[model samples]
Target: MAGGKTINSVFRRLAEEETIRRVQTGLYDYPRYSELLDRTLGPDIFQVASALARKFKWEIQPDGASALNLMGLSTQVPAQYLFHSDGPTREYQINRTKLRFKRVATREMKFKQPESAVIVHGLKSLGPDHINDKTIAKVRDWLPEAKRRQVLRDTQTVTQWVRAAIREICKEPVHG
Candidate 1:
């Protein structure tokens, strides 16, 4: 009638406009995020750790022994990240990796990871005996040479706590 457009066409346009508004405003549910999860899970351990930490709502630092293993300096395997969290217990089994998520005492919390990055930190996370001067020298080459001296200088301070902890954990004699 008004320029020859029909009333039925006007009403149909209005209905589509409402549906578009609802979808844009999040009135519809999409399961596509699960596909994202499926794509990221299992093969990517660190990604899974990050996702799991958020899923459980915790503060996490994937360093210590975890970094050492990823660095190829340690032959031993890590059982967990020793995540110092204010959250409850959570255990994530990502393929062969076992990540432990548990509550930590406030005093034990860390603000900065020693190795900076997760993979680097895992390489340095070994027991006291496992991190000898030779082992340290071997792993040092992996870092930029400029950083090696500083990392070596920090080793005494770095492994001090780890050495003490391993001794206490094993309840046995300690070695360098």
Candidate 2:
């Protein structure tokens, strides 16, 4: 219940039923679903390379957090928000916070977590580059010291080509 008014309670309940607990009210706790995803792919944020390729019906590699690991930017999390898709690739931003999504293919949509779904919309809205260096650094700093190197190494896997495309999309100044 991201501290919203009573009017939001009903939605919150629905979200919770979907394992999408309100972090405040309109906002929700996507991390909880991340943990669940680790245990089982159900109700996740659809944050995988194969998943996005399937969902968007495009052939694009991940570029942000998912790619960051490939780019030596950071190690992998037991589960972290994913990047990619047909629309736009970016972290969800609202009121200075970011929403996370679990990657999933179009066919796999049924398994995506309810919380992650809303958050993914936020990221899609932000577009790629929504996760800038500052945010990457923040994410890097947030992880445990032991995981820093691995994350950096993993982030390195994220190539600039896709990142540039995503940035282009984000910089488009367009919204649907």
Candidate 3:
């Protein structure tokens, strides 16, 4: 901790002993293991991103693709875990996977409800043409009761079309 050399030496020893794993420069975690799977499991991408955002005092949200994936609206795995933040753009490689943070407008980073933000971003990734009745039903089924209610309540702050789409997804039977 006294100097870069000392820190590197300490980290290297810890890694070699499997006491801790390096995530990225100056970041480390105690690795998690699944006995049933008989393999190591990586840290949750969103949790890692949230930690980094807090460390740097930045507002952050998952980007469209990441949001879709996070909400189980998309089955495709992303090559990179992406987030939009008000901080400067940056990238990190953790356990051979890329984590990217792209700078975005202050307004885009603000959301009063987490479910609304995730649903909006996930719907944006699907696009209007892809969001049919079946898609809306899937999203509705995927969301828990409380989150469904919250998304409906939070729709007031979103744009007209987005609010309508969210209302439809929540199965409110009326868009207002």
Residue lDDT tens for model 1, 1-176: 35435754554566466432112111221212257456422234555566666766677655566556655666576655555466776775544667776677654443343343332345344544565555545454445545443444343343455534322322322458
| Candidate 2 lDDT score at position 109 | 38
lDDT of 3 by residue, 9-86 (tens): 999999999999877667778888999999989877887898899889988888889988887878877889889889
Candidate 3 contains a number of clashing pairs equal to 0
Q: State, as a TM-score between 0 and 1, how close model 2 is to the true structure.
A: 0.23
User: After TM-score superposition, what is the CA distance of residue 120 in candidate 3 from its true location, in Å?
Assistant: 0.6
- Give the residue spans of candidate 2 off by over 4 A: 1-12, 16-18, 21-56, 70-73, 76-91, 94-176
C-alpha RMSD by candidate, in order: 13.6, 16.3, 4.6
| Superior candidate under lDDT, 2 versus 3 | 3
- C-alpha RMSD of candidate 1: 13.6
Q: Tell me the number of clashing residue pairs for each predicted model.
A: 10, 45, 0
Superior by lDDT: candidate 1 or candidate 3: 3
Residue 138 CA displacement from its true place in model 2, Å: 23
- Candidate 1 Cα deviation (angstroms), residue 36: 26
